[model samples]
Target: MSNNVVPAIINLDVKGPVISRHLYGHFAEHLGRCIYGGFYVGEDSDLPNEGGIRLDVVEALRALDIPNLRWPGGCFADEYHWMDGIGPKDERPAMVNTHWGNVEENNHFGTHEFMALCELLGADPYVSGNVGSGTVREMSDWVEYLTREGDSPMVRLRKANGREEPWRVPFWGLGNEAWGCGGNMTAQQYAAEARRFGTYCRDHGDNKLYRVAAGANSFDLAWTETLMKQLGELGCAYRPTGYMQALSVHYYTVSGPWRDKGDATVFGTDDYYRTMLQAARVDELLTGHSNVMDCYDPGKNVGLVLDEWGTWWNVEPGTNPGFLYQQNTLRDALVASLHFDVFHRHADRLVMANIAQTVNVLQAMILTDPDSGALVLTPTYHVFEMNKGHQDAASLRVDLPSGVPTREVESKELATVSVSASRKDGRVLVSLSNLDAGQAADVELDLRGGAVTGVSARILTAGELQTHNTPDAPDAVAPRAHDQVTATASGLRVHLPAHSFVTVEAALA
Candidate 1:
């Protein structure tokens, strides 16, 4: 370890955009066990449930105070038919889930179940309407079915399915990935389709829909440019409209190429560092997409939604290849922390980001065992819980004056530390991550502008980078009370361990 301590500054007076609580959102797709076994174990199961929804899963996710949950898919949303999933569970027709394993989907958990799940979690619903195979009327009727009142046909159908009142679906996704799985359409094609489809998705009374068009595939700037060129302007005024309020992007952190994304728990320091490097690329991705959006909407009216993101690794051994189930480790937690740091930095343009999935899938917060219905909160979950205080908080400017710590790996320099801060209610929350695998460092936070009365903190790290929680040892990589931070004269001095993520909560005067 170097004797020279790294210095970072956080000016409490420098107020930035409100880090949308929606930025700390989650995704739950119908793929894999993310739905059927992970969240819904049937109403008659021994595991306690609320109307077929797992109580344990809901109770666990409730800790994060999750703001919004995007539903029915990455590719599944584009192919899904809402009518098939609603109505009585038994009577609902079954179909082949061609995207994620050729398993039978009984359409058990549909619109009602999802809304019920949202009610259980107190989160807003971000419904992803089908665009690839669904028609304009299909998507329009879905919005009405969930949000409309009075004697409408869609409302009558919703009532017949047992829902009396309307649901507040504030965020709606126009489609998933349009260039690939959503449908192999060109940028120009999807933009036109989105404009047409979005036109019919009415607000339906007080339920205002923020329609998000399926945006770029990673750093595909042309796709974003086309969307802005086509949908960014509404009529001759060139004004922003609710028809296309945001654009969605999907990026996953993988250690290797897509053919083989390295094992989740069987990675060395080199693999870990490479993963961190890939995770850090989100800053570049956001900035690139934001630059394009700036050309059309300089006021930042249209938001950029990183709706699908997180670590994607090969499925667990023996699991279905298409299921995308993987283990979450200390490395995964650090990746999440890194992404949140970048997300905070781009809060002006970035509005919401859902970590690939919430349960039993890629970079899941909670992993459920199919046999016993036991739930193991992954290390990534701790990052969310510890940093929940930053939600809806005013973002604070954090600057590194002593130069960012960097480590050269595989001929590339990787930033070893990431930091972000925010102030909420009279408290300031600072989140930091040390991405180094074997070196601990001392960091002095030169805090200015406000008087901090006292500070308390927590740290999440394990003995190794790959250390993860299993049902047998759930706390293997869980967070513990951190006492390494001392109140210095100007601010606070913190000692960050290798491959660790920490959050500091300070009472401001």
Candidate 2:
């Protein structure tokens, strides 16, 4: 065991906000290989698959207990027309994915395909409707096609396309990034459009819809305020109707400008520090946005959904620039953990979040090579796997004093330790991260509100900050049993390695 330092005492209280499992949600889009090569490899491919979906990817995602998956598009959602993707695959209309890759979208993987994927993963489907290019009637018909059980033209169309029974999609995004690619409309304009589209997005028999309006982009507080104020003006009666249930926001951790987001793997200590600083800013963004939400929604009736978030680095060498594909690293994992910690602490207002693209896109969880049939789980995937225990667990309040500290790019003091605690199934799980690059931390955990009987821990770390897994070295950075945790007379003590993430599960007495 490493030498013990000044321990950071963490006192956790059992009663707190209940962490929503949807906070561990994911997002998938029609960009690059995210759909075709990453998740679905074709039924005829030589690679092992379950009904055209990659078995390896499916198993990996299922292990994380992915609660929900936002689909169709990020920017692609606004431009997409659902009718083109249904019916016979060969006869379906082909269109150019102008928002992502300028390549042809063959329409092979459409609404049915996404729902089928969701079924296999046991995840709820959150479909983003096309409001920029498609009409309100088109959006209404799409929802009806998926959820309506009674006789309807859309339902009949779905049946003709092969599905006998309708699928249940509880979450519906009114539009995506309406302030930009979604239509470049003003906040007031988008609010009116959202209301119009949401009004017609009727709930099918027994199928309730959680309508989410497209929120601000990053620190655009005015956009959030304008939308919420407009929705709030609609009065209480409209709340139960098709009004906004949540507002969606998008934020990405980019080290540099949009054109040059820096390299994913080749970076120095400064880049690492800066990237983490940006990741930590999510807390600030959420706090500021939630403050605005409280003004119009003092009751906190509507939730804030972080629908698109993750690190956006430079595209891989030789890949199409528009694809937004970047390799995942330990830095990405740290970013994910930081975000999870923030989401857990603010579970009251932040109900759901989706980490950008799940596979083969920006900060992807899994990377696949179609040529070699190589499937490797990224560091971000392990972070998700380790924290899966916190799903649906009641958030535990942890009071952690500043420990060993590191200075970020702006020379601001940052605690080397970050943590969040939750309880479920009579077990208390505490997730801790040691952010220092070269110093291990001995943390004294003060457990309150319960007696601890047993403790077991698992940690994911690497010898080098830039260490990552390739197909050839898939096990380079994976989780291993951490045996340094012990129940102290006062509470519990844990030894956290440098540049590592550890999850401690304690049996409560």
Candidate 3:
């Protein structure tokens, strides 16, 4: 298929706001490969590991520069007793993971191991505490253990466990999934619990904790508004350096209803358009949720942490359905790129967003084979690597013209591309993705009346729709560099292939 070339213009002067690093954050639940096989393979593996942390996965994530990681649980957070997983692996009591398959969860990867992994990757940690099944003292003591500077009860306990120095744990989640798996509480009930726990979650004075209240599952703006109204509003906390900072939101793109989520990669082009529609809604969700936040805090000091966002599908065959282990394809990569552009578009409001899991779980970056110890980087990882330019830079929004819209009997969707540009010191970077799958829509970039020079591009795509990586062939869907970018007097003309994802960067003359 040939892309219709159109005259485009891009302005170097008109830029948007700066990008936030939390937008590039990740998640790791204590389920499946995410803990045991995905990132932690034990220090004694023949496949090569550092103190049980997979070296290759660490290197790949470090390359993308993962900003923060949420750990220990999803639903598991609600049932978890932090003490059970801390002191010793063998002596630790055996507990069944009520959330993921009711599997026996050996407390091997505990507090120290998780903190050590964060240290290895040079990333921050967001610890999710239990509200449904734990007490306020339990939550506060956990905080004291990680953040206290001098000798205290929790600090002495930390020292007893071997880590004398305080770990810099900045983000703390009050709870996880309050409505359903967490505990079927109405907004009022959860607010009472939140106030009880959040009030006692005192600061230890060394590593400042930005406490995040357990969030509503999705785009229920009313829940957010009520959360602030019922509990002490986030920004109004007494200390300027707070124990409470932001509210979180979790949403997933599962097409064709919740039960039958079509196929992960076998969808038709129409399905691709529908999937992108749901994925692109992250932009709208942020706008709505932030509007609610602005009402309580006009300065917008309160942030929105999208702690969970990604594609969800039935588990891969032979894997436990409860585990959420699924495949990642080129189609998923396109969806991910679109989501990144959305985050950059709303950088000020969206403080952070973490995909469901980092590896071996839904929409993960890296996957590991249990028996063979083989690992593969997913298409989502490639999308993240390409967009690394926007990690910590300011976002600049350009005037984007309307493109052909994709309409269906069930869903109404638009296909126009959204792009965010940023300049750090001297170099200007623009990250863009084409959501149009049926046809390649040419974007006439207005280069602000300057002649273009020194252009380059990199793209990741595959010919077959179902193409992916496996134990034997891990590089089947890796990114390929593209040099087909062209510069013009008016602007630049870059071809975006149909049903493919690409990122372009250039030096202005």
Candidate 4:
């Protein structure tokens, strides 16, 4: 720690972009039961499924107030042939999933199923197009199929497929991780291809498409620079119509080591530190990529989309590792809350983001039984539910007077305090997760221009750090309404619990 220097103060700046509720978005990929047994079935399942989409799952997601949903693939979207999904179900060609588990894709949950599911949840749809192994016509037609209302071949096919009205898909991705799973294409190649495909991506009357070019792998600033150079405002550039909306980036937290991902359900001081250390990278990737984008377009012409991000780890043992289904713990709750704070703080340059998988996949929210009608809420879900107040609210920068130490997870020197602010329905909501495990922090909030009248917190913590929900002990770790909060004379003093994450809502009088 520094003797003279104090903790950095975060300013709300009075005003900023209204945090889009969509920023608290989620993702669903074809990997694992994330699709087949997770969100969809054969429409004949006994486990409360509708049109193959699970009913309980939809209702649960709705409870989280999910704003937008990215679909089809993490790696799956790159090779996704959107056509095979439409038309008929039985006759649909069977495709093999090479990147993920090599399970033969039945193409049951195609475009129609996905759009309809999105409609059921009332969430905006974010579709990742195929740039790795797909063509421009295929990608363009997909936009038309979902958006165009008139007599285009794609639209006609869509109408015949079951949906009469266009979904008005608002978000579109040019590609998914082209540097890796997508196609192993160079940044320059993907950028040029992005322009070519993005140029022709027309929006049908009702549907407004925000085309995002495939972004760099992780910390590839060179790729971002090259892509920007090609875009150089190119004289009248794209179109009177919006050609490109955002440049995308994908990053996952693979802590300590990847080969030995350790236990997904285990947590200790070390686990907490490693998790926060890795999770904090969201902030790094944003600024690093943002700097590169600014060099090319100083005007901030393009939005940076963290389309895919979350804690990555070894899949549950006995489960197909390739499916990426893992357990979630209170540590995951803190990670989720902290990541949301990152996005809120960087809401300007970052217009949109989606957690990798919503259910039954990487750091998923809901874990369901493939056979039984049972479902368990993961710590990630509670984080989303608790921090939902930040949705669509203007971000107010928050600063703490002191710093904390992360002694457990190898970041013992200095640990960053996780905090983000948003105003909703006249109340200022501050979601804070102290990275320090088992050590509570006294947060003296200077609610400038506001008075702290009351505080309510919903916290997720457990008796044991590694305690998790198994089939038999599903409720072992869950969030409970907490009460160690009170208003103070100077501002407000709230005792944040140790190894716990809380969403504290302050009433500004």
Candidate 5:
């Protein structure tokens, strides 16, 4: 630690936007074991099952209070056909997942199964409709099957299939990555298609749908500009019956190019620093995309949905390369904390964001080993679990004193510390991360509006940057009670360890 470097002071004011619970959302694709072996172990499996869904995974996810879960994919959603996955598990048609591992998808976990899993986790289901290889009628009927109550063809089919009551699916994605895997269409083409698909995706009774249009890929400002401009023009000229409620963006932190995304667990300090810098680019991406959105929708009518954001790395050695199965480490915890801070800072425009996956995938929350019946919660999971208090809480404006640690690597500026705070139920919850891999931070809080009487915290840190939990060592990197927080006369004081994520809850004096 530099003696000349001043301690970071976080000033929190109560007047700010309310952090959306949806911001802490998660994503699940049909890739690898994320759905099959990760969450669903089949009804007949001896390893604890709830109608085929893994009970341990459900219990862990429920504990995190996961707000929403986007289902069936990254690129998989655009290729999925809702009809083939319904009816009976044994009779469902099997298709090759060309986008992912090229493995055969048995279609066992369909709409009903996903809804049942959501019910088990107490999470809202955000279904991504197939627009690339599917029809508008197909998309409409899928929505009707899940939300429609009255007599309809889809409703009748749904009832005949066994579920009498319609599941409340409020969030629907029009497409996923339309510019790439989703038909490779131009922005104008996708915008028109989005309008068409969204028009027929009706709201059943009180189930108002929040339709999210497939948005830009990372820093592709041109894609965002073209889509928003085309949508605006369409609305003005044709006065479209249905419009986009949100524009979805996808960004992942990779250490290198597409082919060589570095390793998930084996990395040094420099690699960790570089990864943090890449994750920090999310702020720039959000800023650029939001600025483009402001041009088309000044009132911010349509929110920016970061439906897919997390660290993507090379697959674990010896695993199927296409599976995208990787281990999560403390480095991932820092990345998650940094991203969450950025989301809260831009909560007004950034309505929702889902981490890349929930389990047995990129930056997964839970790692399941069915062979051994071992379920491991990653450091990333502990970050989400600790920061759960921020859900639906009113965001507090935080002003950090200048002179915070900043590094310039590869022409990018990365901050060593990331912070976000919120007030809910008369308790102020602050989440902080020390991105520095070498030095701990003595951070001081300058609270406004009221004095803090008591302080309690949970911290997730490891002795090494690559520290992670394996099946045999599941408790290796779990969160522990933070005893470094103490109430100060002015506000509160916290000792933030190096490369650590901490969540502190303070009660007003």
Candidate 6:
């Protein structure tokens, strides 16, 4: 390892908010192969499946302890009509997916299929409702169909469709991207629409909804301010009469222009640093929104939900442009690590965050091959598995030295090292990332408030930043036991390899 060392302090005595497991949530949109071929294959297919859902896919995601899954759409949410997706699969209507690839959607994986998926993964479902072209009664009926019982019309329809009892759906999105893909409505227009739509999404006997309103588009404080003013209150122990429980925001780390996101597996050092710079900006995004939210709901009654995030790279070459299929690389894993560090810092108000699309989509954890029944866990998948220990753990403050190393790209300084710590059960897990492409970081963690007894680590890295897994070489970038950690009475020392993400699990005495 190089002589350069990064010093940081982990104050175990001062604990912050419990890192919500929902912070590790995932999204499964109906875009591209994300639904049909990625997560679902026909029940009659040769591959291992349970009720038309793929078993291999569920088995892989279960390792991450997936907390919650947002479904049905990104932009597709607005155009999705719940009625078309219920009852018999063959009888269900098919619509052209105008937001995604303009391809026909069979509505095969409707509410019941989604609920079955949640059960398979042991995750809660976050259903996003339509606000663009659907009626208020339609959204109300869909909620009732999924959660209500006791002789209602929706309950009758649900029973007719074969679900004898209602399923619990905790998270509900009123609308998605109302300013753009949802309906092209202004901030005021969407806020009014959200208030009206949120009204009828009633709670069932035992299933309470965490209603999330359509919030801003990346750092648009005006939109957030509008929602806060119209729907949120200045100070209240309880939610205002018509206030939504949470607000949703969207931000993607795209290295290039939106129309032409750079290649996923073909980026140089400069491109890597630029991408990290963009990912690091998520802190600013959260701070800006939090400030606006704090002004309206001082007690933090309204939660902030970063429901859509992750890298948005260009689709792999020779693929359908609208499918959003991309390769997940070591660079993508670093972006995820950096985002988690930021999420940990803002865990108090940030309730939940879901990566863009899960399998076979942009920055997906698992990529499935359509031709052959094969699966590959991306580098990002390993990161999630390694950091799963932090879920629902008490956050510890990581105080960094003033001279922490950084790389300047295009007049912007990107921190070369990132760290976050949390305590769960009797163990403390410290996640460290060395972002430098050429230099390894010798990190000295000052462990306070508890005596360190032992330390073990595992690392995920590749020979190149663009190195990724395919069906042929699935374990090319998987995590392996690392041996570069030492623990003493006062602290722990770790050698983090360049372009790598590591987790040091320590026993605190």
Q: Give the TM-score of candidate 1.
A: 0.98
Per-prediction tally of clashes: 0, 0, 23, 3, 0, 0
lDDT string for model 1 (367-444, tens) is 998887779999999999998998999999988877878998778788898889999888999998889888887788
Please give the lDDT score for candidate 3.
0.78
Whole-model lDDT for model 4 versus the true structure?
0.78
C-alpha displacement of 71 in model 4, angstroms? 1.3
**Alpha carbon lDDT at 267, candidate 4:** 50
User: What shift in Å separates residue 269 of candidate 1 from its native position after superposition?
Assistant: 0.9
State TM-scores per candidate.
Answer: 0.98, 0.96, 0.94, 0.93, 0.96, 0.98
lDDT per residue, candidate 6, 1-509, as tens digits? Answer: 77769888888777889999999999999999999998899898899899889998999999999999999878999999988988888899899999788999999989999999999999999999999989999999999999998989999989998999899999999989999999999998998898899988898899989999988899899999898887645665435554378898999999899988899998899899999999999999999999988887878878899999999988999999999999999999999999999999999999999998899889899998888878899999999999999999999989986556888888988898999999988899999999999999989888878776667899999999999998888888999999988764568788988999999997778
Where model 1 places Cα greater than 4 Å from the true spot, the runs are 1-4, 232-238
Q: Which residue runs of candidate 6 sit more than 4 Å off their true CA positions?
A: 235-239
Task: Provide the overall lDDT of each model, using Cα atoms, as 2-decimal numbers.
Answer: 0.91, 0.87, 0.78, 0.78, 0.87, 0.90
- Scored by lDDT, model 6 comes in at 0.90
Query: Candidate 5 — what's its lDDT?
Result: 0.87
Q: Candidate 2: misplaced stretches above 4 Å?
A: 1-13, 233-241, 401-408
Candidate 6 residue-wise lDDT at 255 = 89
lDDT of 1 at 50: 89
RMSD per prediction, one decimal? Answer: 1.5, 2.0, 2.6, 3.2, 2.2, 1.3
Candidate 4 residue 368 C-alpha distance from true site, Å: 0.6
Lowest summed lDDT across 10 adjacent residues in model 5 is found at 233-242
